[model samples]
Target: MGRVGKQTIVFKNPPVISCAYSSVGPKEAAGPLSTYFDHSYEDELLGQDTWEKAESKLIENTIQGLLTRSGKNPTDIEFIFAGDLENQIVASTFGVSSFNIPYFGLYGACSTMGESLCLASMAIGGGMAQTVIAGTSSHYCAAEKQFRYPLEYAGQRTLTQQWTVTGSGYVLVTHGGKGPQVEAITPGKIVDLGISDTFNMGAAMAPAAIDTIVTHLEDTGRRPCDFDAIITGDLGNCGVDIAITLAHKLGYDLKGILNDCGKMIFDNEKQDTHSGGSGCGCSASVFTGYLYKQLLEGKLKRILLVPTGALMSPTSGFQGNTIPGIAHAVSIVMK
Candidate 1:
């Protein structure tokens, strides 16, 4: 691997995404891209007693489905990088440990999908691993319990608030495979614009997304028009608009190429999802399902997937601290 420019790393032997799996809740199944997912549960609980367990089940099912679709077993995967929005990422740890693969638990909040893909691709590009799985999960109920109030509380949601996606997405990446190539990655730095409203996740994360997107473009000496799409993790409606305006000010035209997983995953009016969707799974499921198919069907030649995250905990919010934001960009292309 070689450094492209500022923060981007161009892979000498770009990793290949062999297979991808997406499983979502019923609500998500009702979305525009409903037919793309591998599976969708009829209920949030997935026959589990708790919402947390349901989230864990989502992760487990994704791993199993990836292995099944790739014609591989647990032993074939060298390592699994996964995470969730739950505290300590328990959903990932408990869900993936059963497979007996080496694990690297991550917590990039909603950006965990891009973060995991970046590291997994590096593992292959660096000749350290042959096969790896990068994945993440999030559940609406589970996230609410940890980040906001329980559903039973009937907490009033602000218009800026986004609904957490109840789903999981996993990718089976390998050094040698027949699939889209992981060409490069740009890791983002923390950028806090002093926005303290935890509900307004899009606003908090837009600057970080813009920072990473522009940096990636500058690093690679590529224009926004070069990619078929520049997709952000979960900026919803509010953040995407903010990012487009901010990127224009930076001398980048992202109007036609830009879209957000948050916006793509839900219909705010129909779903009653105020801003749109937000959570680790928002981007993960969308990429694994809809975007991956778009690539495979020859609709897109190259695309940049940037998952943005709001680095905030309940404690920080309660303490009245500003929400710091981050994002990571992974460039994927079909040869």
Candidate 2:
């Protein structure tokens, strides 16, 4: 593990993403990437009594499914890093507790997935761990009740509002695999442009995403075109456009190759997901399900995965505090 620039770290012997799995709800299953997801259930509750429990089950099931796909057991995992949108990250805590692996409950808002991957790569590259699992989850009902209002309220949603995805995704990171390798990571800074509208997450997170992208490119001595694609996690329609425009202003043109997991997970016209998908699961499921598959199939050689997040809690939002944005970039290269 070596520092590249101000916030970037380049792994000497990068960890390989040996296997990945995605489990999504019915709505996401009906979206554009339906065929890419590993599993989908029509029942959002997932046989659980509460939505929170269902989300926990989602993470548990995702991890189990990934292990099953990779032919590994819970005992084989050396460390587990996971998180969710729930307060105190209880979703990930309770979800993986049964596994009894050395756990690290992370909280990066929606960017928890990227943060988990960054740390997992560091642990493996720095010779701290041999095998690790990085995962995240989010639920529409749970997030609605926690962040905004209860599902029973039936409150009006603004046009800028984004639908929280009901899904979970997990990836197994190890060494010596015919899979994509985590080359480097750029940990982002907290950037607040003073946009406080809770419904408009895209506008809030765009600046941070642009900042991380610019810094990563400069640190790695590479341009946007150096990679096959540059993907952003959960930026939705509004944030993707904002980041692109901001990058252009910085003389970095990312017009054709910039893809957003939030936009790709759902069809705006067909799914009626107003702005787009925005949640931890929005990017998590898309990456493990769709993009990782592409990388393994040799469709994409190298790419930058930037997961953006809005650091705002219900208490802070109600107290009239501005939402700060952050984004972490994980550069992956396929062997």
Candidate 3:
């Protein structure tokens, strides 16, 4: 592939794989041992105790796992770029404070993971930083209250609804010399499918997925089967179906090949993950905890991870406008 731009940064000793991730979850978590639930506190109120504490605890647990797995001291990290969906980013702030790592905060709803990776790669590619950590987290309770009503409020969710995951996901992207060099970053090309429906995020995000996938294939000159897996962040069940339909329309077959984090993270009967899982933490946790390990184990070679976000604000919802969606793709290859 041709260089996208001037190579301002070069790694003297590209970062190699030391350790990838760590997960903390509720005991007897649904799908994977890596998955966790916050049972520390159970409350029906929005902005209650569990929501507040879970966010910070999720971050703390995630950082601790990363440190323990990598066997690196917190002081070794140069910076931390973390984000969450809570108001004023309270969870991320508290989580980072516990580790005491200097960092930047961000928010992109469900697209946070891709956003963080893009920025981290740039910092490493530009020689601006040697070691940086980027991660995003979301709590089901926190997000629900902020974006919708409290669960106790018993708001009916439609088939197109996406259930939020109560967890956190983090990735340690260091300078190329220290870990796996970022091989390629197909910056997410925003493609609006001209959809509008706050009630059905799955519908909104499907077009964005189609747009990104089509553009990415064109840009890289690769086909759908070229990758071992095509993963979408929070498309859930309905969105996955829509994406598949869209792919077929574009002359691509993604039926059995596509996977959604929301669907994979929990068993339908046991967890009732409902349409599927959303939240910043859903994709983040799955990528770092499940997908990264799969790559290390040789089960997957090249993978396309696309994190989708419904860009409907409260104002937009109030105005009765449909939710606009966006998706960003990060291609990961194991050699």
Candidate 4:
């Protein structure tokens, strides 16, 4: 071949998608058929526990599930990336230890799933590794104790409150010729509505989801009908309504296609989920465990998942600042 001509080679086989997840606490603590409502620690004593214990257990269980399902050995995994909302990343640290896979820890509030997926996809695309594992977890009791107080305290919650759930979710991403390849990722664009209500995270995150979905549609030139379903993270009841209204103003009719994980997981009247969605585990578990399974079963062909997060700190609230929200989108394809 002359210098005028050049040749390129590409991998013939691509990575396959595999996921594993776990949740703690009593499956029926909230009530009959309320297994999904209660987070990991609803059955535990508040102040007497540490986030590391539960977080590690959940992560370990999730990874084990994935390994078993995919029939892959832990040693074959090239890297592991994990995170949680615990102080000093206690859960992630202990959780990754059991696998003994080389990895990095990450944090991006409730939007951890989207953030982690973005990074993992980029890593695989760049050929930095052949296989990678990414996941995030959150515990209701741990988060509540750190962010507010123990549930046993029974403190009055403000109208802007969101109930955190305890659970862990994990996904395995590998290079070409191996695992489920990442199809597409709509990088989360930061959209600030200038909202200042920390107590009401549902409202704070609603606008961000709206902004992201609109931008994603615009950028990809996709219409609402292009995808089979559009799902959101823990927006709860109030946020879901806000999302519907804003989406209507955008000229997209999502009345039937739109759903929120927070609202779908529990029966509001029976479980008393209160205001509806919360926690990293909320969307992660539902998406990976439930939705993913459905897709694999031919129930869904194309799906869009937009996970939202309210980025607020205790100091920000005390300083009279409102919570800011962010959202990221990941488009999945089965065909």
Candidate 5:
């Protein structure tokens, strides 16, 4: 791996995404891309008593599913990098611990998907590991209760608020594989616009998404038109609009190339997901299930996947602190 610019890394030997798996809840199962997912549970609890354990089950199922799909055993995976939208990323830890694989737990809120992928690719490209599992999970009830209010409270949601997705997605990155390759990675810097409204996460994270995209383009000397699609993680309808307008003002035209996973995962109008979906699972499931399949099918030759995240803690919000935002870009190409 070699550093292309300040923020971007161009891999000398790119890692291939051998296989992927996604497990989503019933609400996501009813979404437009429902057929793409490996499994969808009608019961959000997944036979577990608590929402948190259900989320852990989602991650565990997806990881196991990825191994099964790839025709690989748990012992074959060199490392497992996973995270979730929970305190200390307990879900990922508890979910993946049984596999006995070397694990690295990550946390970037919704952007953990991209963060984990980028690191896993680096591990392969740098010869630190032959294969790695990168994944993330999130639950609607678990995240809602931890971040905002309990379901019992029946909290009122604003139009700008986004619905947390209940699901998990995992991808297997290997040194030599027949799949799309991770060509480059652009790690984002924290960009806080001093927005304190926790409910409007899309608004808080839009600028960060735009900033990271701009930096990636500049660092790689590649135009936005180069990729078949420039996809952002969990920036819902509001954030997508904001990012487009901001990019336009900054002399970047993201006309037909730009798409958002948050918006793509759900039918916002019919689903009543006010703005759209926003969670670690939002981008994870969509990319692994939908985008990866499209790449493998030769429908898309190149894609710039940028997962956006809001850096906010429940304590920080209660303390009246502004929300900081971040994003990371991973360039995937099929040859």
Candidate 6:
């Protein structure tokens, strides 16, 4: 492994994403990318006792799905790195517990998938491990209870508000595979533009996406033309527009190349999803379900996957703290 500039790591022996699986709740199953997901449950509760338990099922099932898809037993895996939006990431801890594999639970908010991928790739590329898994999950009901109003409150959502996706995505990263490889990664810095409205998280997180994307380009000496697509985690509509406008002002003109998981996960005209989908699962499911297929099918040669996050807890927001944002960029190329 070699460091590129400051924030980016250029993997000398890039790790390959051997297999991936996506499992989502009913609402996400009705979205545009329905056919891409490996499993779409009939109910949000997933036959579990509570919404939190249902959320854990998303993670558990997705990891099992990955193992099944890759034809690898639990013993073949070295470690599992994952996280979620729940307090202390119980969703992850409980989800992967039955697997009995070594694990690393993480918390990067919505950017958890990108963060996990970065560390997993480094573990392989740096010769620390040969096979591992990197993944994340999020649930609408669980997030609502933890971060906003309870389900029965029937709180009216603002137009800028985004729906937290109830889904999970997992991938098997190995030292060898013909699948997409991690070429480089740029771990982001916390950026605060002093926007505290939780409903407008897209606005709060867009600047961090811009920062990581720009820094990745500068570090690797690449241009926008270098990638077939540059995907942000959950910028949604409001945040994506801001991202394009900001990129243009910086002379980067992100028109055709820029896209977001939030924008693609659902059809806004048909679905009542306001700004679009946010949360960790929004990007995770999109990548494992849709983008992974595109890369494997050779439809997309190169892409920059930057998962953005609004780094604020309910306590922090209630205390009138400004929302801080972060984005972790992973360069995935068809090999």
Off by over 4 Å in 3: 1-18, 32-48, 176-181
Q: Residue 169 lDDT in model 3? A: 67
Candidate 6 has a TM-score of 0.99
Question: When superposed on Cα atoms, how far off is each prediction in RMSD?
Answer: 0.7, 0.9, 3.9, 5.6, 0.8, 0.8
Task: Supply the global lDDT for candidate 3.
Answer: 0.71
Quote model 5's TM-score: 0.99
| Residue 119 lDDT in candidate 5 | 93
What C-alpha lDDT do the candidate models reach, one value each?
0.94, 0.92, 0.71, 0.70, 0.93, 0.94
Task: Compose the digit string of candidate 5's lDDT tens values, residues 79-161.
Answer: 99999999999999889988999999999999999999999999999999998999998999999999999999998899999
Q: Write the per-residue lDDT of candidate 3 for residues 102-195, one digit (tens) a residue.
A: 8889777787786777677667656677667787888876778788898799898776677777666676776543333455555554555666
Tens digits of per-residue lDDT, candidate 4, 164-197, equal 7666678877765532345666656566677776
Judge candidate 4 against the unseen true structure and give its global Cα lDDT, from 0 to 1. Answer: 0.70
Best by lDDT: 6
Model 1: CA > 4 A from native: none
| TM-score-better candidate, 1 vs 3 | 1
For model 2, state the Cα shift of residue 203 in Å.
0.6
Residues 1-335, candidate 2: write the lDDT tens digits.
Answer: 69987889998888999999999999999999999999998999999999999999999999999989999989999999999999999999889999899999999988988999998988888888889999899999999999999999998888788899999999999966768999999989999999999999999999999999999999989999999999998888888899899999999999998989988988988888888998999889999999999998999999999988999998898899999999999999997
**Per-residue lDDT over 155-221 for candidate 1, one digit per residue giving the tens place of the 0 to 100 score:** 9999999999998999999998798999999999999999999889999999999999999999999
Task: List residue ranges in candidate 4 displaced over 4 A.
Answer: 1-15, 27-52, 158-160, 176-181
- TM-score-wise, the better of 4 and 5 is 5
Question: 34-91, model 6: which lDDT tens digit per residue?
Answer: 9999999988998999999999988989999999989999999999999999999999
Q: Of models 2 and 4, which has the larger TM-score?
A: 2
TM-scores of the candidates in the order shown: 0.99, 0.98, 0.86, 0.86, 0.99, 0.99
RMSD of 1: 0.7
